[model samples]
Target: MRLSIFAAALAAFALTANTADAQTRVTYKSAKSGSSYYQMGVQIAEAMKAAGDISVTIEESQGSVQNVMEAAVRGGDYVFTAPPALVGAARAGKGPFEARPSPKFAEIRALFPIPSLTMHFVARADEGIESLADLEGKTILLGKGSFGADEGAKYMTLFGLDGKVTVADAELSNAVGALKNGQIDAFVTAGSFPAPNVIEAAAGTGVTVISLTDEQVAETGRARLVIPAGTYAGQDSDIVTTSLPVVAYTSTAMDDDTAYALTKTFWEQKAALGEAARWWNGVDAALLDNITGQIHPGALKYYDEAGIAVPDTAR
Candidate 1:
């Protein structure tokens, strides 16, 4: 009788163990190091850890393309990417994901759009370089690798730069140093200012941060975003041009329940999240309605329970 009872208890334990194991583990990956996406992801992972019992993990990855592939293949459940990349993948099915046609877009959904990385180009004040047009035939430290190359391309398109613009493949720090050493004519970066790298670059390099004029800002805002002053560190006195917004995309594969829980948690602790990510300061709880994709039913339920107005689209 004792042996039979022991065997029955062991069987029950096995069933419970299997039941607990059934709860899926979700993992997220972000672009390489020194990126806000990676940092915010680390913070979110911490938040998930604090939430308890939910098995979630966040890892560093090779940037948007790799991330999207991982999500498409189910190698990862979520990824932090940019709107252009997501839309490009979904609309053209040309980049990042091809085996899956653009129609397979439903495989991924856009969770939310966050502000872009504030980008700028800095040249020594004494260099006689005043406008984007002056970058012609000048050596500029664009970015570390592909990221830097993209930054350079954006500016080139923005200013319609036609001169010889030399780009150096260097990290932010080295890029700044290159400017100071005359190895490069200027340094450009897209990040929060007093961004450690920019701050270091400014200390003695006499770097002058430049941006588009008010009219330019207005024009760009029509196509993109233009930030008000104080968005980055040096904007108040050091930067002469208006700021533009660079939106980042979040992983959309989170189930309705998990998405709801995460969204609810994000708003509930808005204060703390804002403190961690400066851009969150602009997020209004009401903007929940403005989410581009369908809000998870769980999130919608949470919004209703919270008494927040659900936008018509959401409804």
Candidate 2:
């Protein structure tokens, strides 16, 4: 009888170990480390772990454009993206995705929205550069190995200053140094208001946050956003610019139950996460209306229970 009891106990332990090993592990792909999206991804992972017996891993990625492609290719279980336009473009095989469009792009689904990353143009206060046109004939630093390079080039073309201005590529820190030393007349970047690099540059040298004129804003096809007065030192008045929404997304490979759990945990613990990151303060349920892709059925399940209407187009 004693031998039989010990054998049963060992079998039970093996079953328990197997159950733990079988738990689903989700991989979350976030942008560059130390970015707001990375921090937010960590928070989501923690919340999902706390609310359910699941494992989550955070992986650093290049940026939104790359993240969307990875999600389409099943490279990761979750991805964070911005502007929402990238999603539409990837699905329709246009813009950055024009070369090799993936039909898998249509299987991508939205999870939630994060804050908008505002586009900022910084120039030396002494330069007398007041608008996009003023960038003509000036040496501008378009961020190295970043989406800003393409965006800066586009801005110059849109404003008819393409051939006139000398565009240079440099990392953020090097660009800041060049800007402070008068080597570069303007620097273009995009991120949450009062971006750390912008603040550092402003503190080191007098800087002007350039604003887009009504016509430029209209021509760019981006939403106009404002950096409220005094967001940074020497920034005395509100600066108007364009912005893109950051959003969380997943692929169809994610099961409905897992999606439901993650979506539910995200909203329930958002306040707590917001406490850790100021950028998270801008996350709003209303922004769900801005999502350009389909809604995951599991996420839709929770939203339906909450009486939040997801557009039929997203279904």
- How well does model 2 score by local distance difference test? 0.80
Clashes of 2: 0
**Can you write out model 1's per-residue Cα lDDT over 1-315, one digit (the tens) per residue?**
999999999999999999778654666666677676677667666665566544557777876666655554563245355544354555466754666664434545444334445556777767888778788888777765555457556657776773468766676667766777888888877654335566676676766667666676554442223445655444464344433332333334566776566656656656676787665565555434334444446556777788877666644
Cα deviation of 259, candidate 1, in Å: 0.9
lDDT on C-alpha atoms for all candidate structures: 0.59, 0.80
lDDT of 2 by residue, 16-61 (tens): 9998887777888867898866877788788778777667889898
lDDT of candidate 2 at residue 54, scale 0 to 100: 65
Clashing pairs in 2: none
The 10 consecutive residues of candidate 1 with the worst lDDT sum are 242-251
Clashes per prediction?
2, 0
TM-score of 1: 0.70
